[model samples]
Target: MSFLHSLGLFATLGLIYGCSTTSSLTSAQQRDAYLQQFIGQTSQSIQARLDLNSIGYQQVLAPVANDQTLTYTVIRPVTIPVPIAQNPADIDAGNIPIPVTPRAQSYDVNLQCKIIFRLENNMAKSVYYTGRTC
Candidate 1:
């Protein structure tokens, strides 16, 4: 009974240690980590993994003889609040109500982030990002 109890305690401690050691990355970090997989991958493989036909995908330029840059723009939706008068009341005999009460009206804006992939010898070498969304 003592041996079994010790083994069970060790197993529980191991499980707890494993769980504690595990970590979760943020959305941007996870995205960057996923994009890193394209490094050292051929253009064909990267194209196969990503949707090349998407509206955001474009071929920017080839700087050197064997170097090329592919740009991918990601559109993100952002909410912008525009203050508008939501309540307005005239003055009553007893008291005067506020002429205008400003309330937030949300409007969605499509922000963009341009990701550039540099390729050499048809293999992706590095990745860069630009624009406000990045």
Candidate 2:
């Protein structure tokens, strides 16, 4: 029986970072008005608080749960754009009529998570021992 030899897990994670909403009117006339509605001006990058650590097992597969409850989830990132055309029929061999396909821009961001673990075999009882994954 080995669940860290006794079974005990505790975790805490919640750190938000880098946020914005729109506040760039030349510093918005020296901040005022409720701090400019909580202020906002970003470089794009929001995510702070994700500490995952769980490692302790020694043959625990029969039924052991002093308080079975485990869950994890968080994912955000999406951007798609790619187009480069030159002399192929700028909508029919350009003629100063319609030939303007030159635009470049890029934004990349990604973060994802999905985990669910809940076990309870008659409240919990089973152990074996060997660990790695935190």
Query: Whose lDDT is greatest here?
Result: 1
Residue-level lDDT for 2 in candidate 2: 45
**What lDDT tens digits, residue by residue, belong to model 1 across residues 1-134?**
47567656655665455434332246457667777888998777775686422322233332222359656666654444433322233333445544442332344456556777898888899988897454
- In the range 1-134, model 2's lDDT, one tens digit per residue, is 44342222110110111112122344323322222232131111101121222111122222222344223343333322322224345547654444444434222334343322333532212212122111
Q: Lowest lDDT 10-mer window, candidate 1?
A: 56-65
Q: How much lDDT does candidate 1 score?
A: 0.57
Which regions in candidate 2 have their CA more than 4 angstroms from the true location?
1-49, 52-66, 84-87, 95-113, 117-134
How many residue pairs clash in all the candidates, one count each? 0, 16
Model 1 misplaced stretches (Cα beyond 4 Å): 1-25, 51-66, 81-104
The window of 10 residues in a row where model 2 has the poorest summed lDDT is: 10-19
Relative to the true structure, candidate 2 reaches a TM of: 0.23
